[model samples]
Target chain A: MITFKNVTKEYPPKTHALAGVSFRIEAGEFVSITGQSGSGKSTVAKMIFAEEMPTSGHIHIGDWDISNIRHSDIPVLRRQIGVVFQDFKLLPKKTAFENVAFALEVAGESTKRIREVVPHVLKIVGLGEKGGRYPRQLSGGEQQRVSIARALVHRPKIIVADEPTGNLDAITAREIIELFTRINDFGTTVVLVTHDRDIVNGLHRRVITLRDGKVSSDAEKGKYLLS
Target chain B: MRSFFRIIRFALQSMMRNFWLSFVTVSVFVLTLVTVNAVIVLNVLANASVKSVEGRVQVTVYFTSDASESTVKNVQSYLLGLSQVKDVSYVTADEALAQFKENHQNDPVILASLDEVDGNPLGQALKIRAYNAGDFPFVLQALETPEYKPFIKDKNYNNYESALRVLSDFSEKVRLGFLILALFFGFIATLIVFNTIRVAIYVHRDEIGIMKLVGANDWFVRGPFLFESICYAFIATVVMGVLLSAFLTFANPAIVAFFQGVDVDLVSYYLTNALPMFGAQFGILALLGLGTTTFAMRRYLRV
Candidate 1:
């Protein structure tokens, strides 16, 4: 349920981050957006999160025009979409459980709801045993799983992982991809943004490749071709 | 009610988590409140003492000793008839001479000089008390009238007028000084509160940002800070009240003995008689604390 209709994003001084890009991600779809550095993959994810508004096009997320979302309403939009960053931006002071619970708390979830939903999401990401551990205490994969658990707390309609495994080892990156696959199987729309060709090739899902700020190829069950 | 307790519990936990910062904030607020309360208390005491002094002072008019007793009696009757006069007492020249001797008993030279004066030169004097300290001018106006000029003693007027002028000037100075002190302390108190809140804001910056992200309304975020400020001021006010009461309790007897001949007792008079007035002062201070804290936190909490 994500649509970017002819979105053209231009930075100042003739720098076009995304030029005339059009794409639609249906609900329950698992998709990978692949582009090399400066190819605007991250910009696409940021637009979906309303972190950056498109310069000249409409963005619709499930019937909501998020293009003009006010700063105050950003948090509300964020609750509807689960976001995972490569750096795993978890508060270091909190345990894995607290980090996930914080998302629910910020959403004003009841204590009962938080207690019930937090452990369930943590278990879904295979972090059930690491709930009590702090971010530093967990492995990189485990930490990313905690971030995934946080994203799932509100049963968000879309899960956008922007280069989530960029800093992890290949094995850990594959493990994170597997977790995302499992989450996508449960009916949540998953959009994975990455530049790693090996990982993109392994995921035989829809691939949208960007080249010089334009969509170069949109193919079902695609391969990474960046020449 | 449960939500309120939750908010308070969260605040206390955060405050305890940052104990050193909270203590600093509380101490600052207390210091400011103490100065403000001290000024208020001093103002109250000064006003009370002025009223007491005003109640004791009267205008005394001396008659010419060579004048007939009938003329002196007429003057006394005339003073009694005036609406401004509360009471009048006539002291004959013989009695006045005896009182003068008794007053100068410690000074033999003064006593001998007074005794050597021919035939008790002191005249019959009428001491007149007025309804209010301000009404003294009205009585003076009556005495200076042309009708009463024949019986007036110019020297008596000259002596008593200077005393009256000095008393009036002292009361006005005391009043002006009290007001200035109160205003100065009030401004300092407000600044102290403002700085204290700013420091607390710096310490809890993260919590505040997180609280805002969690959909907390502006009031919910402000409530705890407001509560903290009031707590500091209220505790200081109570402590100052107790210490002041104890001080007045133990020192009252000495004060009463010192001013025994005066019309009012300073300490006991306030403790027993002006308790309600003191309570009002406390209430005003509590409100001042609230107001100052609220004002200080305004810019810091605008988010």
Candidate 2:
């Protein structure tokens, strides 16, 4: 579970990235955070991973009060919350297997565990057969799948995918979304940060839409609408 | 333990993946060591040259005809007592005349002139050798003491002054120039390494960000670059050692022939101290490479 209570993240010179953004994500739920560019959806995902801290108010992932997490503890927090970036963020030199294995390796997982978990995660993301391929060798969708495979390698409780389908085609985007839905069905929390209208309408899941650095609507089954 | 192995594996993979960068870094390191070793060789040669010149210089203090043999012995004892004078050999008037005749035996006129002169006209001499060429002046100045000044007809200190000055000054200047050259190359090598590592880090900046996002610790992120630096240092050191060995082997004969009577055993010198000397070079290169790599990675590690 993650909670943002009246959280505000302000850049200097009076620029507010997120103004008193309040939201609660329960465990085992799939949540979509939809907003325009600069609407602070990605910022929310970054805060959840402790990559950014709010200027005011509270942000908690489970019982860990990450609003003021220590520098040494940031890595520990990151290991628990799997984050997928918009650009895939795969290391070019590492093969698809190594890219996924790196996540577990960073967490100091045993060699046997990494050996076991990476293949399982790649299989989950439907890239089990192409583990030997490098990032450049794979297509855009396949690269995005590798990124998701990396996020799942640690068996994290919450998977935060920030515009993961941004670089993929319509069918590929839906495929990635379907993968996330399947992941969510396994009782892991999924926070999808995207502005894709069709994807958001198709989700039929809980959605928190942001506008003007504030939450404009919260619905159980939200529809995508630009305001 | 597994993490340690993983770090080493990553370092090897990174180095191989960026083969050209590694090669360039190691080449710069080898060139830096080359400059340093060149400076060391120049210093050893200069020291040997100075010593050879100093050995050739000896001031012979000739005594007047009236001075007795005992008086010459007293002067010789006095010169020997002085710390600056390394050795003092007393040459009698008769012995000096015999040496003169032996030297000019090919020139009959000079030999006949020396034989015709009445009963050993050459003065008794005290040939003084000083420990250092620079100290020769002080040894000559010590002769101004009232004890042996009156009996001493002529001191040959001024005869060797210009030669000693030239030898000492030239050796000093050569040593200084070599030092400056060594430092210049060292500075250049440092910059080349710093820039090379910076470029490598820039190339992997995105991967570094991803690594951090995946929960890699600071060491986990930096281990590959740091270990790669040590690898470059190790390779460069070995290459430099082999090159130096080959150079000394092929060049020693020419150098020995050029130096004629001068004692310059470069092969022996390097062979005796190769371990500690090359160990220091490797240590310094590794330290410099690590420092530059750490500095280059600082901005990228912010994530």
Best by TM-score: 2
Instruction: Report every candidate's CA lDDT.
Output: 0.76, 0.87
Which one is best on DockQ? 2
Question: What's the true lDDT of residue A161 in model 2?
Answer: 95
Question: lDDT tens digits, residues A40-107, model 2?
Answer: 98999999999889999999999789887888888888888888888988888789999999888877
**TM-score, predicted candidate 2 vs. hidden true structure:** 0.86
Model 1 per-residue lDDT tens digits across residues B96-176: 788878878899998788778777778888888877767777788888767667766742322344555665567567656
Residue-level lDDT for A7 in candidate 1: 91
TM-score of each: 0.77, 0.86
lDDT winner: 2
Residues B171-226 of candidate 2 have per-residue lDDT tens digits of 77876777787677777777877777677677778877888898988888888878
How far residue B153's Cα lies from its native spot in candidate 1, in Å, is 4.9
Give stretches of model 1 more than 4 Å off. Answer: A70-72, B1-28, B65-73, B117-120, B132-138, B144-303
Worst 10-residue lDDT window for candidate 2 chain A reads: A68-77
